[model samples]
Target: MVGQAQAVAAPRHHEQSHLRGLVEVAGASVLWGTGGLALQLIREHEPMSPITISAWRMATAAVVLLLALLALRRGPELVHLARTRPRQLLVVGVGTAAYQGFYFVSVTQVGVAVSTVVSLGLAPVLLTVVESVRQRRAPTPGRLAVLATALLGLVLVSVAGHASSTGPDPVLGVVLAVASGTTYALTALAGGSISRETSPLVLTSGMTLVGAAVLLPLLAVVDGPRVSADPVALAWLAYLGVLTMALAYVLLYSGLRVVAPSTAVTASLVEPVTAAVVAAVVLSESLGPAAVAGIVLVLLAVAGLGRPSAAAGPVLPDPGR
Candidate 1:
């Protein structure tokens, strides 16, 4: 009876832990969903180029995270990560910068909603394929079906007439968005793998520092390098750096420690929905019928993932346990 009771408790505990990881990943996505909108708000006051904005975002996040690590007397961990996993950290840092750079540039060409959808929506597909290849198995039919549903929704959001019209160059924007998604997928895999042995806070600090170092020099490439002086715009940039970059990523890496990279990215599909809704309410942007339907499908797909299915076999075991 004691052994049976222990066995019963173990699976229950595992399920609860998995659920917490999902919530953390989803929460991070919600914060990230606000990013494009915040960037848009900053542009309204300063008209900074996307590259300049990207540099600032990374630099700001790096500073804040480093300071926090020092405050906690965890500064040595950053050095340890740099010395031990230099290659992996560089990949994550450069990958993070590249993805955000592509995404911000895409926003200039495509507007907020479509750029957000195309970039974020594409990550799960790429990551899922990567996972399947790594695991040496095909995704179960149920997993494939869920992926298909999510992709269809993404397609709708991307091509809807009203959604496309907001961008000056939708085609170029989409190309950049794809670039963003691909880089994002690679970064997620690297970070997720590394998080298994590292603290999320330390990992995030090291990555952001590398990201900032890589992006800072690119500011010169911006046409004018317009830095915002407005208090409100500065505040918005702080929000982007602190909330979206630092906090969101901490949550993300934490989730990745327990959740499979593919599933973690899938759960983050909530980002586009959050972005679309924020755009509609704050920017008065219209989502149209198809776009609305697409949001619903994406939400349903996320819900489907939360439940047990054949795909459950692919889920990474809870690493912390």
Candidate 2:
């Protein structure tokens, strides 16, 4: 009787832990979703180039994260990660820097709602394909179906959000946005794989440090040492650096302990949704009927991906055949 009781309690505890983790990941998504909206807000008052904004954001985040690591006495662990996982750390750092740079540039050129929806909406599908290739197995039917649904939804969203105003060439913005997505997917996978063996804070701090180092020259050339001319712009930059990039990553890493990587990615779909809604509400941007439909489809696709697949057995890789 005691054995059965302990077994039942174990699962209940795990379920609760999982719920807590999901909440953390959802919170991270909410912060991430605010990125574009925040940028739009800053751009309204002070006109800054996207590259400049990205560089400052990364550099600031790196400083804040490094400070936190020092405060927590994790500096040694970061050095150890550098020695053992240098290649992986560099890959993640470069990917992180590139994703932020390209994503900001794409949104500035193509508008926040459209660029964000497209880039984030496509990340999971791409990640799934990458995971399958890495595992040396064919994707199962369930994954295929989810990918199809996600693609269809993406098409609907793209068509709905089409603009006639001829902003920066849509083709260029789209190509960069897709590249950003690829970098984001790679970073997530690499982070997850590395975090399995190391402390999340250490990994995050090191990556941010490396990314910041890479962006310093670009920031100097593009912005010429002007971090921000206006107080509001400075505030937004600080928020992005401290809350969204630094703290949010720490929360995300913590949440991953209880959530599967696939589920965490699916949950992050909330970010784009929040960004679009904020744009519509605060900026008074019109999404049009097709955009409404696309949003619905994207949300549904997210839901479907969140559901457990029978073939995969709750997080198991599907059989190759």
RMSD of each: 2.5, 4.7
Against the hidden reference, what TM-scores do the models get? 0.90, 0.80
Please state the error at residue 255 of candidate 2 in Å. 3.6
lDDT by residue (41-96, candidate 1, tens digit) is: 98888888778877888788889999999999999998999999999999999999
lDDT of 2 by residue, 1-321 (tens): 999998897656665665666567778888987887777677776777667676677778889888888898888999999999999999988888988788777865776546665677667767676667767887678766655655565555555554542347778787878888778877877776776667767877888888888887785567434456788889999998888888778777766666656556656766756666677887787887776776676566655544455111134221111
lDDT, residue 235, candidate 2: 95
Task: Output the number of the lDDT-best candidate.
Answer: 1
lDDT of each: 0.82, 0.70
Q: List the residue pairs that clash in candidate 1.
A: none
Q: Which candidate is the best by TM-score?
A: 1
